[model samples]
Every structure is written in structure tokens, then in C-alpha cells.
Target: MKIEHLTVQGCNEWNEDALILNERERIYGVLDGATSLSSAVGVETGGYLASRIAKEVFETSELPAGCAPLRSLVLMANERIRTAMLERGVDVNDKNALWAAGIVVVRIGEHQIEYAQTGDCMLVAVYKDGTVRTVTHDQVDHFDEKSRLLWERYSKEGLPPDEVRSRVYETIKQNRLKTNTSEGYAILNGEPELEHYVEHGGLNRIQLSSLLVLTDGLFLPRKSGEPTPSMSDMVALIDEKGLSGYVDWLIANEYDESQQGKYTRLKVADDKTAIRIYFE
Candidate 1:
């Protein structure tokens, strides 16, 4: 197996995304720290800490050599985050102090591939037949469509980026009220019970030739009438430019201000992390 990965911070002051690629163990993960909550807290961002903790747990723990390790891994990671909060005098019960994140984990076995995901992180399996299937879906996308539309409107009106960011932050904060609850999306927020919400599955090793795991940061812009890039397009770009170059293409081609009206999103640039694994 060959694994290539990259984590790039957004245009923000700090990059909050974290990742782990253990080719030897055949375990891979990507974590996206929620920016709104992290910005509100005075200390280190919860998303950053939570992701680091999760990566460390996955790296150091004596995980069982099976598909079931995903659940136990998440549970242990949550426990570690809880203990860290208590030790730091952080109020674990306070939502503001809680580190929250969307996480995806993939473990490649000799004959199969196992995956588990919570929140919006995604996993795309590229089969040998040149077909692509998304294993995980975004949880937050549908939660605040109205707010995103309003932000787009504001952007079209020539609002400053900072003002637009503030508005979106408020919207994200409000939407987070549903996090971990029945009404909201599930995330790794030091709550072990939320593990049940994890979406997981397996694929036959013979069926998949490669895997791409990504945080929500990487997306194709929809130009008025132009078709959004398909999975094959994305894979082709990666094949031609590699992961870092692919992200550079996104920033140059899609995230520019001149492209605003044609390509609008909640955030202009987001921390992008991706892992590409090839079974050779």
C-alpha cells in the first residue's frame, strides 16, 4: 500500500484540521475542527486539540486488528479529550469549552477495507472499474442552507469578507446548538454515546483500487450553468496534479474573489486535508 497525504490551513490565522496516515498499521484519519466554537473559547481551539488527541489515540492505542476498532477508537479518543479538559480546568459541560470535530477513519485489511465516520468528513472509494462511491455524507450541509443562502446574498452585495465571516460564524454557532443532540448532527465532542451515530461500512479489497478521504474544505464550485465536477473529474485532477497541486488548483480557479458571484460558499477558503491511499 502507498499513502500520500497533505493538510493545508485555510486563509485563516490558524489551520485547525489534523490528520494521521499510518501506512504500516493501515489506519488513516482526517479531522476537521469546528471553527466557530474554537474561536469563541479563549484557550487553544477545541477543534485542534480534539483532532490531535484523536490522532494520538489512534496512533498509540493497542487497537484490535479488526473492523470493530473504529468504535473503540472513537470511544477512547472521547475519554482522552474529557480527561484533558478536566485537567486543564475547562468546564467539560460547557459547550464553549468542548472540543468538537468531524472525523473519518479508514483501516485497510488484507482482503477488505473498514471505515467509520461522524459529522461531515468524507470517504470516497475508487473501484477498479473506475467507479466512485461516497461512503460518508455531510451532516452539516443540510442543517443551515438558509443561512448559507443569506451569506451568499450578502457576498453579492459587496459586503466585506470579515463581515461575511462574522455573519456565517454566528449562523454556524446557532446551528451547533443541535450538535450531538437528536435534532442536530453528531460529532466527536468528548461524548462517548455519540459513537452510535457513526456511519461505517466495509468494501471488498478486490473491488477498490484506491481511497480518498477528505474534509469538507475541498469542493467544486458551481458556476451558474456549468456542471459541477464529477467524481471522475476530481480523481483525474488528483492523478494529474497530485494532492497539493489539486488544492492549489482549487484556490486559483475556484476561491478567488473575482469568481465570487460565480462561485460562492460559506467560507472563501477552508482548512483542506486529504489522504490518498493506493493498494498496489
Candidate 2:
């Protein structure tokens, strides 16, 4: 298998998304840090610190010889974050002190592929016939319909970035109460117990021609009234153009300042990371 990957920071001053691809070890992963609620609670941005911990833990950990190592990796990463927070005198009980993450991990084997995901990061497999199958779904989508509607409304209101961010933040904060619970979404947040919430699966290697792992930042832009491209359309675009080319088109066509108001998005831009692997 040949691999290509990239990570681009969003419009923000920092990029919270992180990627780890070790083709020699047949390991690929991505983590998106949640935006910080308050910088005063921690030594650095929660998202940045959490992502760094995840990457470090992943890089140093040994490869899994069993079902999958994602659960263990997330568990260790969470412990590292908690230890760091405690060392900095940050209150472990405070939600603001703990960083949360949406993560995806993939391990490619000679005949099979194993994967695990939590939160919104995605893994897509494209078969030789061009059929695309999603290996994991967005945990956020499991939110109540009312919450989803409210978010969509806020996204389309054309509010200032700060105002929009505040609204979104509050909503997420409220939602955090349910995190790792039966009613809430699953994310890595310094809690090893949350491992059970992760989604895992396996795929036959011979049936797949390529695989793509991406964060939500790479989604198609949605217009106020018009429908956005379907997943098939996105896969087609990537097939026609290379991964970089598709990303270039997305930024040029939708994210540029000149294109504002033409499309409605949760954020002006988001930290984008993607890994494309092709099996020969």
C-alpha cells in the first residue's frame, strides 16, 4: 500500500487537527481537538495539548497484534492529558481543564484492515468498482434533532464569527454533560472508560482499492437553500482529481473570503487533515 496525507490549519491562528501515518507500520490515524472554552483553565489550548498528547502516544506505542490498538491508544492518550493537567495544577474535575477529541485509527493488514473511530473523524473505503462505504459515522449526528436544527439555524444566520463561535460553544458545553454517557456522544477526554463507546470494524483488503481518512473539515459546503454534493459526489471528485486537488478546489470555491455568504458552514474554515491509501 502507498500512502499520501496532509494537514492544513483552518482560518484560525492554530491548527488543532493532528495526523499520524506510519506506512512502514501500516498504521494511520487522525485526531481533531475540541476548541478551547477558556484558556485561563489550562497552560495551553485544550485542543492543542490534547492533540499533541494523542500524537505522541500513538507514535511511541507498539503496534497492535490483536483486534485493534485504537482503544488502548486513546486510553493512554487520555491518561497523558490528565497527568499533564494535574501537573499544571489544573482541576481534573473541571470540564474546561480537559481537552476532548474526535479520533480515527486504521491498521492495514496483509489480508484485512481494522479500524476504530470516536466522534466525527471519518474513514471511507473505495472499492475497485468505485463503490464508497463509510467505515464510521459522526457521533455528533446522533445529537437530538432539536440541537441539530438549532445549530443549522445558527450557521445560516450570517452572524459574526465571534457570535457564532459563542453560540456553538455554549451548545457544545451543554452537550458535554452527556459526553461518554449513554445519551451523549463519545470522545476521548482523559477517560479510559470511554473506550467502550468507540466504534470498530474490519474490511477485506482485496475488495478495496483505496481508503480515505478525513476530519469533518473536508466536508462539502452547504448553501442556505441549495443542497450540497452527496458523498458519492465527493468520492467522485477525489477520484477525478487527487486529494490535494480536491482540497484546493474546496478552499478556492467555498472557503475564500470573497465567497462568503455564498455557502453556510459551521465554521469559516476548520483544521483539515486527510490520509489517502492505495493498495496495489
Backbone clash total, candidate 2: 0
Candidate 1 local lDDT, 126-150, one digit each (tens): 8888888877777776765656576
Candidate 2's C-alpha runs over 4 A off are 39-43, 61-68, 143-148, 151-165, 226-228
lDDT of 2: 0.76
Report lDDT (Cα) of residue 184, candidate 1.
74
TM-score of each: 0.87, 0.88
How accurate locally, in lDDT, is each candidate? Answer: 0.77, 0.76
lDDT of 2 at 249: 84
260 in model 2: Cα distance from truth in Å? 1.7
**Predicted model with the maximum TM-score:** 2
Per-residue lDDT, model 2, residue 31, is: 88
